[model samples]
Target: MHRCTLSKEKLAAQPGGEWTHSVSAGFLKTLGCLELLSVVGLILPAVLDIAPVMVPVTAVCWVLLLTGAMITRGRLGQVKLVAGDAAYFAIAVFVAYGRFVIEPFSS
Candidate 1:
């Protein structure tokens, strides 16, 4: 018995086709959104200090997003991207943890 394999041609032709488009678009959008949120969360809180809560919230979200990114990239079968993404993700998590635990919020 032989298992079905996706060919480069098949994968490429329909990439951004039906389900592919939606899933890819959603994931990419989510990634971009998370980065933006992370920045806004870290900076806005430190500068505005409005809620001062935004920092932790954003940091957590960043770590979460990176987790998703790492998973998605892994499933998508991109090794180089996965490695880079995971490394960055680790950094993000560390920063988040640092903000929440170590540095925390200060007046």
Candidate 2:
């Protein structure tokens, strides 16, 4: 994982790891940690029915994160990567809208 690897060379060895060079390891690790937590926030509360509203909140957070990702990729002229980010952004937006408006879980 790029986040765990301290050596730039080691990170570059992995597929798509070259992107790690654009940012500091600390930033990457922080981002990775946040993403991991966002995933947990998306699933755990909903599954346990403890705070299902967190699912939509997490989805909204993911959308914001992906928006930053898309801007970064676009600035780097990574058109293909931007497209992928757009797809993820769309999915996050859909999830947020669905959970918040269409089928929100009742408390």
Model 1 / residue 20 / CA error / Å:
5.5
Reference-based lDDT, each prediction: 0.63, 0.83
Candidate number achieving the greatest lDDT relative to the actual structure: 2
Candidate 1, residues 1-107: lDDT per residue as tens digits?
10123433343355322323434544544555556667877788778768786776776777777676667667777677778878877777777788778987775
> Candidate 1 at 45: error in angstroms?
1.0
Candidate 2: worst-modelled 10 consecutive residues by lDDT: 1-10
Q: Clashes in model 2: which pairs? A: none
Q: TM-score each candidate.
A: 0.64, 0.84
| RMSD value for candidate 2 | 2.2
Candidate 1 residue pairs in backbone clash: none
| lDDT of predicted model 1 | 0.63
